[model samples]
Target: MLKPTIISLLMASQLVFSQKKPATTYKYGYNGMELIVKNNKETIIVSTFNSKKAIKDEIALKIYDMYTKKLFVNGDLLTISGNEAKVIGKVSIRKKGNLVLLDFYYDEIQWKTGLVEAYED
Candidate 1:
């Protein structure tokens, strides 16, 4: 009986250690552009880049489409500026007017995605 209990405890410990922790950042590469999202204080910070330059319209649209197909329910992409747009969903993605910030809103505890990048945030 003691041996069985010891085995069960070891197995339980292994399972606990094997589970992945929640991520606070994600990076995605699309058509040569890199999109990054990080949790900052209480807000999510998003940015995009192509080589060394910032990515605009087309790339941002593509990212929105990709995320929509993968994670969100049906939603509309609303243009906010020449460089950005927002996808309305359970978790909304909105572009900041300055062209450098993308605001993401969702309950982190309830949101999960496979696109989370493995790099440090």
Candidate 2:
């Protein structure tokens, strides 16, 4: 009886430890040039890299601009040419006159391609 109870307790403890915590959720900013979202105690690039066209159309675009080193909100749909990438979240960009930003993601293949292309001729 005692052995069985001990084993059950051990199993329950393991179960609790093995369960992963849920990813954290973040709210979109209304009208801002940059925003940051955090998950699991880490800062992942949730959105960045908006183009100029998005601003003209007033459509919400999430982008991470490598040149600016900051996130921006634009007005365009995030597009990935290949099947490896998908939108991780629904991003919103607040409209305020002529300024705009677009949201984008670096999918697994897109990310890998960048690495490979950087070293290629």
Candidate 3:
């Protein structure tokens, strides 16, 4: 009985240590303001001026991250190709900060769907 108990404890510890944490991917868009996300696959309008222009001309974007709750990006802060990126889509929060502190890739796909389409596939 004692031997079996010891083995179970050791196995449990290994399992805990071996498991890896999940990552959070954020999607961002610009409407009147820049919006941040922690997931993907979303649609949004950027700014009132652009929103009134047309659908195809609107801004479409996605942000990928490991773990992030709040994203800080704006015309003065963050821009796409020198131009300002507006937020007009889905935004998700995170529990911890992994992508922010870690060496991860930030894929700014579909900044403007009319110009280019940013998809997972």
| Alpha carbon lDDT at 67, candidate 1 | 60
| Predicted candidate 2 versus true structure: per-residue lDDT over 18-66, tens digit per residue | 9855432323322333445444544433333221222312222224332
* RMSD in Å for model 3: 16.7
Best model per lDDT = 1
Q: For each candidate in the order shown, give its overall lDDT on alpha carbons.
A: 0.38, 0.35, 0.33
For each of the candidates, the C-alpha root-mean-square deviation to the true structure, in angstroms, is: 13.0, 15.9, 16.7
TM-score, candidate 2, is 0.27
User: What's the candidate order when arranged by decreasing TM-score?
Assistant: 2, 3, 1
What candidate 1 gets wrong by more than 4 Å, as runs, is: 25-121
TM-score, every prediction:
0.23, 0.27, 0.26
Better of 1 and 2 by lDDT: 1
lDDT order of candidates, top first: 1, 2, 3
What is the total number of backbone clashes in candidate 2?
A: 18
TM-score of decoy 3: 0.26
